[model samples]
Target chain A: MEENTTTEKIFPPGSVGLVKSQDFHFAPGEVLELDCGRTLRDVTIRFETYGTLNADKSNVILVEHALTGDAHLAGYHTAADKKPGWWEEMVGPGKPFDTNKFFIICSNILGGCSGTTGPGSPDPDTGKPYHMDFPVITISDMVRAQKHLIDHLGIKKLLAVAGGSMGGMLAIQWPISYPDVVESCLAIATSSKISPQSIAFNWIGREAIMSDPTWNNGDYTEQPQKGLSIARMLAHVTYLSDQSMSRKFGRKLQTAEDYSFKFDMDFSVESYLNHQGTRFVERFDANSYLYITRAIDYFDVSDSADGDEHKVFEKVKCPFLVVSFSSDWLFPPYQAKELTRLLLENGNDVTYCDIKSHYGHDAFLLEYETLGKLVDNFLDNIYKEKEGK
Target chain B: MKIAHNPSDSEPILSRSDLVMIADMIPENAKVLDLGCGSGRLLRVLKARKNARIMGVELDQEKLIQCMERGVPVIQADLNEPLSLFADASYDYVILSRTLQAVKRPDLILQEMLRIGGKGIISIMNFGQLDARMQMLKGHMPVTKRLPLKWYDTPNIHPGMLSDFRDMCREKGIKILKELPVSQHRDFLRFLAPVCPNLFASNAIFVISK
Candidate 1:
């Protein structure tokens, strides 16, 4: 049976199988303008695609990645790779994204570190890394850069723009920023604006990184591992719920049945967070973290509407699907409901759901059964409607 | 599951007669919002027949997926809770079919329906029919074709008669634009239902405006 299983398949059922990433570099003369009133040149975007684009080019879908996520959304990069894409379950041949029927594209955001133009990328003018010199960005800025990529690909209108968490913010921005180009949107487990509580958490995470002596004011020879790990540890707590933490750890000791009587990371939850922090520091740059979180903090779709959140989407014409988790304190269900209300007030067709889950904000990554079905059916319906059948 | 048979061959096959009657009340190209829309059968018929812009709110996740499968826009929400997400007078018609008894506050839901929509259509099971009255006379709870479940196990917590609905509407200052007694079975009750709706009809559909 072991030999049969190993020889029978190169990839699992519903898998996108082996995939490769591609890069898109902006033309020299293009010189993209930023929301912060600065101009950037030689911008690069790392992206990946699945399925075929079709004859009419109407089967394209742009999937946005959340914080700390990259262009690799589904399938194995290599045959021996232990982990598939972050959204492996939702983006395969028969999964919610249904790669067989629609061409799926996911790109690293402009301020993202994974093969995208960010703080670590070299500055053409200075002949060194941009570092702190990288223009301050916003969610809209990331989406603006994405629009250029979509236009370059010659897709006149996208079937849908979808994502969760910070990705959700980008999804929301796409429809508003380019209403005529996007046919629909799926914003899951996200808010239109960052709440004060969220801002405070981001502040603490940034503070942890800046406090490290090795950080060297964002110009350190070596990456600030300790500070970045501490930041990741604190940020990880916000991604989980009290119920989830209690169920997973429940004050369980790491190696002993009794208390250690000293602060040596004895609790299981502490050890788990430490491991997450250390793992994150290895792949992510601290400077990129500062820029991306700041972009998230500055995101407010209602800025053009005199701070009236209800009128943010008045000019947007596409239908929307908004999903939130019951235990997601970071982007609570009420916040999502508020966005739905705003859409309804403008007479926009919007479907909203608060999925019952204990996985908190991370429910967007987990809870595939319920969330996946919602996306699958939602996107299918939109496609059918667009076809006029 | 027992499928309700409709006598009209041109109408949708899966929908009950009461749902057909409710769909008939809506005009062509009207925007509709259906509360407690189970599997979106009525909305599908409306979309196909009237070319109506359709949306639904269903509590059951499975039914919500079924609605999406039928290309009907739907929101997952409890009818018992406040439906404040929908703006006032946003829809041309709001429908609550065969779900009045199951909700915690049918009166409040009616008001909310009319508040969000220009007109509200409701189809309720008539508990005062002759079969139920006969069961009561025999000192047993009702077990009619329409009200099939036992009293203790039923989700219908506030079942009422057609007269009760009229009186509630009068007291609540809700104008009943039209009312129709519906009987799906091909029996004498179908003839008598229209004459004495409170005692013979299996169900009643009401079109009301605020």
Candidate 2:
């Protein structure tokens, strides 16, 4: 449990490399007691907030970050300074999630690399880093922790909750777990559950980590560089678009005019993969990545909650806006359409948009003009109805 | 939550300007039917401004409830479905708001609306606006605050403008009593929308007598 932080610092000062992004300073609260019947006793959570919490606490917008996300949603750190959060496009002044208007909160997830009570955090019972000893967490457990946070905030009902990709999964799950506490929901570039194809990719990534000798069956006090790097490489493949690779590489050479390639980063794509993997391992904990990926692998909200795939749609009793990018093969537009169709059939006010983008799964993060307008308009529609009152 | 504005004081309930011209076309104190009367805003104006006995048709239960809450009589009905339940010539004037673009068949609904009432009033979004034309040339469907949807996501089956609406009306053989186009926010374009209104207007409100 007590593995040292890092050696040969790859992240520049204030770089916000995969983990240890405390620059924004989302204070860690008490260890959350688990209801999962697992050995994980208590969990510490890092979280941040922006704007003033309204008197009635109705303007709270809970932002659930993605798989590789930290609590930093937007704004700079006042003290040990860092750049703004990943979603600077949508959370600033006059932006979609304008902090001036609503109370915005983001929390590092339970199994996340950022300062949450995850695999990297020391296990008090064993006096060591939790490592493999940390109990397996479900997406539902993450929602339960969020519920506790809301209770702590003394907020009865949230004005709205929004996110994209894995974060989007959490947004949809919130209404399911705590149906009464939400007024509106915005899910972007995500599905209600993980697809089989996604599960296969995640499983292969996990295999890559386990195959490396440095893993040492998850007991290595030292960094699992080989395993973690390989795992990152595999996961990186899923993130990039086919077209992006085609344009970037197109079967192109890396070093020389022709292939002198003998077990080196010969192809341009190979070099890109190596760069992504090495940089990822520099700040990320291998064990934590594994745990978080497993959580994603197991996340299928339609199961148990709704026995039938279509039934999941009818059960969601809220005004929702589901957005998906045409280029996002990770969670295609059809799933969002399915949710819309079922909601429409079940007499729920559901709005859907399939924006045309060539950016793939990362569109939610990169495509601002499209994602920003969709979010701004959605929040605007709800805000306008609240305006006269 | 704000006090419902006076109909005659120049604020139209649905927050559109062409409504003023369309409201003026409505016969005074005659039986009036308003289709897709969202929140009963325009019908309340008709009631207060012209002393018109109003019946509103809405698809969304929430909007229908809003109409009822406003003390306006409303019936929940879909435009694609039949509206022959009402007796023949039961209304002197039937009004259809900005819902023409969203319906399955604008032609069929208009015929029923005109058949039930001695005269019909139809106000639709005029897609022939110069801005939409500009959008067409840009290769990508230009999204604006007014028609804020991409080509892939718009709920409207057929979004038409001033000229297309009038041509369809003429083909249906419905006598045009008044054709008013509104482009500006409210008062500015209401007076100026006749010749060349088809180019600049956002909506065309037509009052047709059988």
Candidate 3:
């Protein structure tokens, strides 16, 4: 939509890398009104679309971003932004989400710190960062915002909609909210609702952010940073696997051999966590973190009905392909299966696979090579059949 | 406590309402085979409703997808053509719901149904209603709620009356374990047709066994 040239190397040959952002402008310094009644003026969403949209705009695949992910799904953008695309393993020329045949669209979520409008934006109502005053948002509300973006792109029907984790939740809702729009869906490492333990971890992250003295009730515009760093460290633990952590570090020391048992970073785990947290603050805003995580925390679900028996199970009219990770304790397998069962009972076309991986809840994002093959096959079938339709 | 094993436990293909009714008739934890199960809804319900093990057979690819989605154990195949897959009397209850009229030869299917389950439930719409007669006289086959479609598009290959089916059952030595008919949807056709339902009843939902 715009004449823009950008490039950045994200990963080594085999693994997946950073997510990118590119889009048409609604004019520079434009203001975006959020569904929460909070307006984010002068806002931009980082986005990338692979393959071709075709003549009918039917081969579009909307990829939802994970917690800390941006829209940059592959390649580079600028020198300031270094790192491979987040889904480097799963998406590329010939991966599962094959960018070769389908038009893949990914965006930095609304409340994300990277390029999207979030709490970091100037609050039109108050000129300063909305901080705690940023109204709470639901997953439905998040979908609502994305709907605007989709409409702007002028896509009519989607061939396949897919995502993992928070992204997966969006993929599942896509068909239900916009029934006739999606042909088949790919929902991985997600659930109908977040588990209790996930909520607890989210709260812990929030508390750690609030407890920091630098987080002056979220008023430190220049740097309400330390608190967000701590929150990221805690969240990072949940993202990685026990086996991965053990294999990568073990009980080995980060520095000295002897037990200095002080508050210093003795274990490699501590050093790794600190590094992840410290890097997070540089690209992210504390207020935005507060807003987005809370949005994810507020997810609660039941039957997708609107009081009509004949119309109740009618919402999810599209074919479903749901995948949940076996080792994802946060959302877990039961919740995923529960989603599968409900959709099945409602008479929707569905396929669910619970992938076995010890990479923990964030495995869907990291375990790209495995996820890549599944995506590739799933899309190739759809693409071939989609030709006639 | 005698629960049978089914392949479709991982993929249930029935609706909530269909499952509820199927559950009501089946004994708790009994062996079940749901034929023409659109996504194994009834079988899945029986599984959860009574912890009964169920095997479902369906033809449609979409419904099969739904069955797998629900984790109800199911096999994607036709219900007719001798069910040599399982042994004789491998099931306790064989269910054919709203699928009788759709089959080319329901009589053969019913015979298989009885052979598979010691007891079986057969739910079919009564085509010998006064409404069909009225439409026949008025020169339009019939289009009531029970017979929703106009003749051409109807899925029912051979529509027959309740008495007609019962007559066929009698010929096959299939005794009526229970026979229930409906007019106002689930509310039994009572007061009007009780002692003799041949003329008054408009729809029939029955349970029979060999």
Cα lDDT listed for each candidate: 0.89, 0.72, 0.70
Assess the local accuracy of residue B107 in candidate 2 as a C-alpha lDDT between 0 and 100.
Answer: 90
Docking class of 2: incorrect
Worst 10-residue lDDT window, candidate 3 chain A: A1-10
- Chain B TM (all candidates): 0.92, 0.86, 0.82
Quote model 3's iRMS.
10.4
Compared with the true structure, what per-residue lDDT tens digits does model 3 show for residues A1-389? Answer: 23224554334554333434575434556545554675544455667876667777877888888777778776545434445566766766667776666788888777777776666656666687666676676666666667667877998778887888888877876776787788888888887777788889888888888888888887776655677888999888887778878888999998897779688998899999999988988887777777777777766544345433334436667666666676777778677767765665565544555666788887887666555555665566567657756
Q: Name the docking class for model 1.
A: medium
Question: Candidate 1 has which clashing residue pairs, if any?
Answer: none
* Sliding window of 10 residues with minimal summed lDDT for model 3 chain B: B11-20
The CA lDDT at B170 in model 1 is: 97
Q: Which candidate gets the maximum lDDT versus the true structure? A: 1
Tens-place lDDT digits, model 1, residues B25-98:
78999999999998988898888778898889998878887888777778888899989989889999999988
> What does TM-score give for chain A of every model?
0.97, 0.87, 0.87
For model 2, the superposed segments whose C-alpha errors exceed 4 Å read A1-36, A78-82, A249-252, A304-306, A309-316, A387-389, B1-210
Interface RMSD measured for model 2 = 12.6
* Clashes in predicted model 1: 0
